[model samples]
Target: MIGSSTGPLTPSRVLIVDLPGPDLTPDQGRLLRQSGFGGVCLFARNFSTEKRTARLVSDIRDALGPHALIATDQEGGAVLRRLDVPMPPSPLALGVLDSEDAAREAGRIAARGLLDLGINWNFAPCLDVNVNTANPVIGERSFGHDPETVARLGVAWALGSEEAGVMASVKHFPGHGDTSQDSHLTLPTVDKPRSELERTEWLPFRRAVQAGVGSVMTAHILYPALDPDAPATLSPAVLSGLLRLDWGYDGVIVTDATDMHAIADRYPAGAAAPLALSAGADTVLSCGHGDMETHTDHRQALLSALREGRLSEARVHGACARLDRAVNRFPGVPAPYTADQRSLDTAQVQRWAEQALTWVGIPPRLDPALPLLLIAPISAPVGGPYGDSLSGAHLATLLKEIYPHLHTVLHDDHDPTAALSLLDRFPGIPVLLATTGRWSLTELPRFLASRLRKEQRSALHLVLWNADQAAELKLPSLISHGFRPANLQALAQALMALR
Candidate 1:
C-alpha cells in the first residue's frame, strides 16, 4: 500500500483480475485479501451447470469478501460466457426489430441472469456504431449501423439492466465499429475526423452517458482526430478531455483489457495498466491468463509510478473510491444465483429473431412432398475477433426440429467442392444455402455466385448470421443477422412457413 498520513493507495483496488479455473486457489485467496485487489471477472472455464456456477459464485464471494465486484461479458448472442440458459439473439437482431421494449427485455434477461448468478457487473450493451460492414470484431455484437437507433436501444438496454439490479457498462467507448481490424490481434486505427465521429460514431455513447449509465469501457482503437498517438484506452485526449471534460461522464471508466494485442503490441500489461489509470481509466481489466508474478509486476508498476509522481495518488484514490461505490451498488448477494429455465423470456428472444429474418430473391416455389435440400456450412464463424464457437450445427439442430426429414449437409471448410458435390447428388431439389454474410464460408460464396449466374436452380440463399455479408457479396439472400440458439429457432420457424 502506498500510503501517507492519508489512506493508502492500494493498487489492487483499481485492478479487475481473473483466474484460469472456477474455484479459488490459496494464491487467489491471498491476492483477494489484499487491500488493493478490487474484483474478479469470470470466464467460461469458471462455469459448468447452473448449480455449479452458483456454488462457485458463493465461493468467490466468500474468498474475496462479500462486496468484491463480480463481472462477466454476458452480452447475449454469441458472447455469453458461463450462463446456462439458451443463448439469446444477437444485438443486431434487436436492432432489426428496433423496438425499445425488445431491447429492454433483452437487457432485463441478461441482467436478471447475471444477478441470479451472484455477478453484479455486466460488461455489455456494446454501444459501438458499426459503420463498417467489413469490421471483424464488432459485427453482430453491435446494436446496428444507425447511431440514433443504437442510442435509443442502448439506453433502453442500460435501463433494463439497472432495473434488474445489475450495473451495466456501455462499452468500446469512442466506438470500435468503423475499423476493419480486430484489436485482440492488432492495433486498429480509426482515421475519421472529430466532426464525423460526433455526427455518427459518438452519438450512442453520449446518449448512454446522458441516460446515466454508471460505467463506460474504453476501446483500444486509435482515433487520430481525438488523440493522434495512443488508443482510447491510453489516450488522455479521448478519456480525459473528450469523455470526462467534454461529455461530462463522471462514472467509472474501465479499460477493455490490457493484454489485448492492441495495447500489448506497444505497452506490456505492467506498463499499460498504469498508463490507462493515469489517462482516466478507473479500473484496468486484465482477463487473460497471467501468473502470480505478472500480477505482482502490475501492482509494483502502479506503485512505482505513484512514487515517481508519474501517476497521481489522488487519481488512484478516486478510482478506488469509485470501484467501492460500484461494488456496493450491487444488491447484497441474495439466495445463491441459480438459473431458472422458466425465467428466461424465450418468447421475446424468438420475436426478436423472427423480426431479424429479412428475405431476398423471388419466393421459392418448393414442394413439401419433395426433399428440401438445406446446404448449411457446418460452422461459419462471425461472433468476434477470435471467431465464435457457434456454427452451422446450431442451425442444423433448429432446422431438424421443424423439418425432421430435411436433407442436411454440413460444410466444414471454405472450399466449395463439398457443397458442389452435394448439389450434384441432390439434383433438382430446392437448395437453401446457409452462410454467415462475410466470406467466413471462404470461397463458397464466390462459387455459389458464379453457379447462380450460370444457371437458375430454385436456389434461395439464407445467411444464418452477418446480414452485411449478403450486401458485401452482392447476393440476393435472406438474413437472420444473428447466430444464437434463439435466433436459429426463429429462422427455423421462418423456413417452416416457406415449406
Candidate 2:
C-alpha cells in the first residue's frame, strides 16, 4: 500500500519506454534502467522467431532486474505483438462465435504465449465499446459494439491473464470507440452526455474492475461532459474520481502511449507526466521516440516537477506502489519463451479461422474455377514483423494452395483508387474477394460500392482479414480472425462454394 505524502516527491515510478523492435540496442536497455523508467513494451518487429524473442526478453529482464515491468500490446487480431507464435482468434472473431468458453480459451492461449516469452504485462482486452463504425482506432480491435458483450469477453481475457500469472491491462479507459478520428494524430472528443457514457462507454470498464483486472489504461480522448478542459489521462475527475473512486478499481492505472499526437502534440512531454500522475495513472507508456536524450530530458522534467511542488509526492508514491506490486507478482519461473513451431500444429486454429470466415459471410456459390482476385491493403510500415507483409503473403499463399485452379491476383495497396483500378480489369464480373487492410471498406471509396452496384454483382465475396476492418464492412463479408495461413483453406472453401 502507498502511504500519503503531504509534500513533493521524487519521480520513481515512470513507465517510459518504447516497443522493442529490430532497432532496439542493448545500450538502450542500460540507459532506460539508469533513467529510472519502469519498463519496456515489445512489438513483433523485435522478434522473428519465438526463441529469438524469448532471448531478447530475457536479456531485457536481466538488464532491468526484477523491479522493471516488461509489457507488450498483445491484444490479438490487428494488435498482436507476437506474429511468429500461435494466437487465438481476434475478439471480434470470438464475438462471432459468441462462446464464453472460446473467449476464455483465447485469453489462456494469449497469456500462456506471453508468459512463455517472459512478458509479465499485456496491454490488451480492449474494453472500449465500439459503437461507431467509423472509429479509426478501436474498430474491430474492440470486442463488439455492445458493452455487455465487450464486458463478458474482457473479463474472460483478464481472468486468463491472472490465471497465467500475467498482469492484464484493460485499456482506453472511459472508452474510445465512438470517436471517428485517430488519437494517434489528433485529440478525439466525445460529445455524448455523461449518462450515455455511463450506459455504453463505461460499461465494459466497470465490468473489468469487477473482474479484478490488474491494470487499466487511460484514454487520451477528451469528454466534454466529464472534463472539458483536459483529456481523460490528465483529468482527476475522470481517472481518480470516476475510475478510482466511483468504480473502485484498485489496480495499476497506465496511460496509453504518451508519445501519440493526441497527448504529445497538445502538451509538453515534461508537463504531461506530472499531470498524468496526479490524474491517477500509475504507469506512463512511451512506445515512440526511444532516444536516450528524450528519455533523460523527460525523466528530469518529471523529477523536477515533483521537486518543485507542482505535482504531489503522494500521487507519485501511490502509482509506484501499484507498479511495484505488479512487478512482484510476475511469474519468476523460467519456461520456454520461444516458439517451437510444433505448438502451432493444432487443427483448432484452422477450425476457428474457418468458423470466423463463415460468420463474416462469403457467398454460398463462390466458383473456384473462376479467376479470383485477392485484394488487401498493405499493412502499416510501423507494425514491424507483425505487419501485413507477413500475414498478407501467408493468406495469399494459402488461398493459392486451396484453390489450385483459381486464378489469383494480389494487390498490396490500401487506397480505394488502387482497388478501383483493379476492379476495372474485372468489369462486369459477378464474383470478387476483397480484404481492406487495417482500414475499413466504409472508409474506402464510396465509388467501389457504386462500381459493385454498376456491375450488378450479387455474388461479391468480400472478406476483412483485419478485425478493425471487419467491424466496419458489415456487407456480408467473411472475416479471418487472424491473418494466418491456416485461414487459407477456409477462404478457398468459401470461394469454391460461391460457384
Candidate 3:
C-alpha cells in the first residue's frame, strides 16, 4: 500500500524527524519504515554513552534502511546534543583565535565525532552574527559581531564538515542574532530590511552557500521586511524567493522545530506542516510525535493538502529530490562503531580554549592554602533543547580535580531561599560566581551578586558559559565563552596563575 497508487504515502516530504526514545520502539520502527517518513533526528535524551549512542544510530539506520539520513545538533558549546564525551570548544572560542585553520580543525573534529557514530548530518556552524548585546539567545553560539569574521569562520567550519564526509547545516537563517527574544519561548522580531540583512546578517549564510554546504535551517523569528505576516520558516518571499531563487541554494532547506512556541502557538502541526512545505521548506522538523493518532493526523494533513491541490505534487517532489541529493552527497560511517579518543586531539582543544579565554578586571589574590568557595547558577529556560541545569556541577567537579580544596555550591540563582542559604553558609570567604547564559542576572543570580557585594566580601564573577551575558554586569570578571571540559580546565589554570 505504501508504494501503491497513493502519491503522498511515497517519499515523505518531512525530513529529519524524531522518535519517541533512544531505542527503536515498535511504533517508531513502523513509522521509520513508512513510505511517508523521511529520516531521523536525535537529541541528548537518545544518548547514554558514545558506544551505546553509536549502536542506537546503527540500529535506527538498519531499521529505516541505510539511505535514511541521521541528524543531530552537534554544535559545540551550549548546543551539543551528545552527552557522552566532551564537546569541542564553542565557535566563539575558535573565532577568538582569528584563524580560519582553527575553525576548520574544530569543525573537522566535531564532524568526525558524528561520523564515527554513523551520523551523516550535523546541524552546526551557527552563522548568526552577534550584533545585539541584549539578545536572549544566540550569544556565544555566534562566531562574533563582525560580518566578515563571522563569514570566514562559518565557511571554514562548513567546509571542514563537508570535507570530513558529514553534511553541515548553517543555521537560523537569515539570522536570529540581533533579536532580544528567544524563539523557543516567544516570537522574536527583526525590524531590518532586506538591504540591511544583505549587508550584515546575510553575510555568513552567503559565504556558507558559496562554499557548497549541504543544508540550511530556517529561523523561526518574524522579519517584517522579508515577509510581513509570517515567520521566515513559513515565508515564501524569504525561503523560496530569497534563499532558493535569488541566492540559488540548491541544498535541503530544513525548518527549525515547528513545535516551538514561535510557530506552534499560532499554527498546530496539521496547519504548520503544510504551510512550511508551501513556503519552500524541504523538511518540517517535528520532535515528539505525541501519539500514533497525532502522527497519523499530521501525515493525513500533508496528504490532504497535496491531494486537494493546496500543495502541489511538483513542490513535494522537488523537496524530496533535494533531500535525496543531499543524502547522496555524504556517505554513511563504516560499521562496528567505536568512539576512539585518538579521533580528537584533546590537548589541541585545551590549547585553543586557553587562547580564546578573555579576562577583564584583575582576579583577587586569594590564599591558595585556604578553601575557595565557588557559587554557580545552572538552569536553562523552559522548553530549550540544550542547557542542562546541572552543567555547573560538572564544571565544579572538573575544577575540584585541579584545586582539591575548592568548595563548590550549586543553586538556582532565581530562588532567594537557595541563594540566601548558600550566602549564609559561605560568609566571609572569597566567593567565585560562575554563570551560564543571558538569564544569569534574571532574578536569583543578580540578587545574590548584589547581596554578596553589600556584605563587602570579596566576590569575583566569571562568565563560565555564554559570553554575551557579560553585558552590563560590572564586576571583576573572567570569561571562557564556552563550557566544555577543556574550557573549564583552561579557566582553572588561569585561576591558579592569578592566585
Best-matching candidate per TM-score: 1
RMSD of candidates 1 onward, in order: 2.8, 4.0, 3.2
| Alpha carbon lDDT of each predicted model | 0.76, 0.69, 0.77
Whose TM-score is higher: candidate 1's or candidate 2's? 1
Error of 2 at 186 (Å): 0.5
Give the per-residue lDDT of model 1 (tens digit) for 317-411.
Answer: 88877776776677536533333543446666676777778877665765556777777666554424323655666666666666655787777
Clashes of 3: 1
Which sections of candidate 1 miss by over 4 Å?
Answer: 1-7, 290-292, 335-344, 381-388, 436-441, 472-476
Stretches of candidate 2 off by over 4 Å are 1-12, 23-26, 337-346, 359-364, 367-386, 389-396, 408-430, 440-449, 455-458, 466-476, 496-499
Residue 441 lDDT (model 3): 61
lDDT tens digits by residue: candidate 2, 1-499: 1121222333644654764365447687667555656777776567667667777777776666666676777777667767665666777877777777777767767777777777888888888887987776776677888889998987887788777777888888989889888888889999899999999999889988988889998989999998999999999999999988998889989888777788888776556777888788887776554354655656776787778887776678777777777777774345454444335523555677787765554444545565555554344333321344234455566666645544444444435655666567766544344564555454443445455656666435455455544334344566555555565556667666655
Q: How should the candidates be ordered by lDDT, best one leading? A: 3, 1, 2
lDDT for predicted candidate 1 compared with the true structure: 0.76
Give the TM-score comparing model 1 with the true structure, all chains together.
0.92
